[model samples]
Target: MLAWTGGGVTLLGLVMLLVLAASRGWFSPVARLVAGAVLGLALLGLAVWLHRKESARAGAVAVAGTGVAALYLVVASGTAQYHYLPAAVGLVLGLVVAAGGLGLADHWRSPALAIGAVVGAGLLMPVVTEGWGPLLAALTVVLEIVAGIVALRRGWPWLLVVGAAWAVLYASLAAGVAGSAELWPAGAAAAAVLVVGCALALYALVTSSTNAPAYGVLASAAVPMLVMGGRLDGWRGAAVAGGAAVVMLGVALVPRLDRPVRIVALTVGAVALLEATGLLFSGDVAVAVIVGEGIGFAVAAALLRSRPTLLFAAGFGVMGVLGALALPLPPGVLAGYPASPFTRGGLLQTGPLVTGLIVAVLTVGLAVAMLVALARTGLLGSGDGRAAMWVVTGLVGLYGLTGFVVGLALLVSPDRGGFVAGHAVVTVLWTVLALVLLARGIRNTPLRVAGLVLVAAAVAKLILFDLVSLDGLARVGAFLGAGLVLLFAGVRYARLVSEAETATGPATPPTGVAAPAGGAEQAAGDDGRGTWGPPDART
Candidate 1:
């Protein structure tokens, strides 16, 4: 702890000193540049010595101090016209210091030293280039890629993290530059940075035995790319980013890839694709895309027997359903379909209602298809697959049933009163379906449990909402009908339970068991002797 604190303080003090010196006109720019270079070299020498002497923390501090001094020197050089030269010199110095640290014994090569060097050098590109634009963005990407390669070779995972951070920063700056000006090239540069970062991340995942560092790289690259792409180019940029993410998923699916790597890649890819779909499409089209992707995921999960993927598939499937439900029917459809609940002020429409009905039907059909696929794939043996199957089944069943009732209401009823009556009838239909489920449950436990839950829900609705809102004949019929149904259900349930208990028969004693003392057998066995004792007197 003390070593870490001291190292931190030393690095901070050096930076502050340089900033103070630069702020105050303590030295000429030429003199300051020369002095900074001298100090940076001296720190590099000290780092090498400390590393050899097995002081890893001190060595890391010195290496970081060297990079900072190099950066300060480059900034102080005052070569505005030749700014790239200074940047190059500072980058080289950072590499030299990093190389010196790497040359040390493995135990003494701190990842912090590599991270510091990469960060120091990578951050100088923007400053040297004056501000974020195509040139700076390009340089930063190249620098990060180089740093990543070095980190991979030296087994310094922290350097990969530094590279990822630089990637995010560069991406943000490039996006800002693109937004402020008509620089079409800046967007391309940002895209290049994203690609490089993703590649480095994939390399890290492939080469490194652990997953933690790979995840850092992926999030840093993939997430920022996604955000920047969407912000800059809208759908076009989103498609590009989504494609990159899909590439990562493909890499993850390699036969030799680690399980954790594959899982992370799959999750990131799935989310990116879904986000892209949301950005690129709307209404029923978006829902269709989501449903298709969800079904694909479910199929993959079934094949791989992966729970996490199955859950993700289920989540996406639900999102599709929600999207479908939220979609608006066209105003023209409402204009034509005068009886539609959505139609108001006598402005009937047709397109939206038809479109909505079609979307709902398609959504239900897709859900049913997914359930059937899962079942046919024989995935029910796995807990995850079974859960997913049931989730899709329930969603499709409920949505289909609701849509049917609504469509009937719209078709049969042209007025508000008729719509209300239609809903009341639907409630009765629900109750009848619940009863069917209950009857089926007598043969299947799962069906029985589902039936019970549905019946309970119906009862709750009748007592809580329907009873209070309904009036006139509707109210009377609802109560009377619910009461009769409850009575019948209770009677049937009792009979079923009684029959089940009776079929097992009663318990009986073992056949070899002896009679109790003074019972018939024992009395019979002793009676001859007792009677004979009285017979002895008789004889």
Candidate 2:
């Protein structure tokens, strides 16, 4: 507490002296900056000298003095009379002094100095440039890259976090400033910095041991910049970002890289590719890109023997199918048509109806292809992996079946009445499917569990949705039909279990165990020695 208080008081005194000098015009801006830098350096040296004996005090003083000096330089450079070069020099000197403090006796105190130096330098960029977007963004990127390198080499992971935070801040500012015609060049420059920063982050990920968190942070920070660049430059910006993402993905494929790191890289790449594809295409083609990428990811997962990636691919594929359902059909194909499927006269005239069919067919084909590929690759050997594969298959099947049913319903009924009737049909379909699954579960546990869940869902839907929306006979029929089906399922399952047990016959004691006296009479078809014998021998 005392050490902190002393450092705080010292920092306050330095700030007061700087303000007094500026108010009274006691010294030139350059002279004051030089003096402050010198004083900060002297204090850092003293702190290092005392570090062994009083490490905490040394750290507090070092952080306070460095922060104060850097602030002075930033404020001075923002003045009309001072050149930007002197402030830049002072900022660099402060960073050097902070870096030197790491060599002191305590490892814990070094992060404070390192984070403060990087953050202080970052804060100075806008003041020095008077908020010029391009220059400030570029400088911030360069600073972050340098800081990342220093931090990685020095093993100060916190400094990487500070750098990543500043990178995001400056990238956002650059994106905001990019909206003006006068700042178009700045936008281009900012875009370039984003790409370069991503590359630098990738390199760090490859080379550094403790850089996993930093890589994730940097990649996350770069995504917005890439998006803004695409928005600014249209197709060209998207192409640039896409290329960088592909490169990152390629690097992630290196055999020696850690699995977690590779997964992160692949994820970032996939996202960037999707965003770029959206910029480059429209309608069905964009949807196709999603499906294609999903399939590709699944294949990669199979080849790499990665379960997590497989799950991701499965999820992505499902989303693509859903997106396809919502997407509009091509204008040429559905010209002069009512937009709503229910308003159309038939399935042929309904755009969404036709699109849904196409999407369903495509989803089924892709799911089949993924299953075949995974099976051929022998990737489903583990129980968990096999379970995941089954789940993916089930989800894909459900999506396709739902699409087909919905489309067919819209085709047959083109009004609200038709819509309600179609939902009722869907309810019946779910119930029947659940019964089939439950029967199949006699041989398969997973299928049985899935069947049970489906039955529960059908019941919930019948009560919650169909019961209220349906009227008169339809409501009564839905409730009655669902209840009967559930009852039948329960009876069938019990009968099968009973029959199986009966076929196995009565239980017998082990050879080492003595039987009760009445046990012999109960086994009338057996020998008197308690071993089963032919019927003729028993008679």
Best by TM-score: 1
CA-lDDT, candidates in order? 0.59, 0.60
lDDT of 2 by residue, 130-200 (tens): 56455455555555665666666666666666766666677667666565663555555555555655665
Clashes of 1: 17
Off by over 4 Å in 2: 1-109, 123-125, 179-212, 215-221, 230-233, 240-244, 328-361, 373-539
TM-score of each: 0.60, 0.57
- Look at candidate 2 and give me any clashing residue pairs: none
Candidate 1 C-alpha error for residue 15, in Å? 9.5
RMSD of 2: 9.7
Q: What is the lDDT of residue 265 in candidate 2?
A: 70
**Candidate 2 weakest lDDT stretch, 10 residues:** 328-337
Cα error, candidate 1, residue 408 (Å): 11
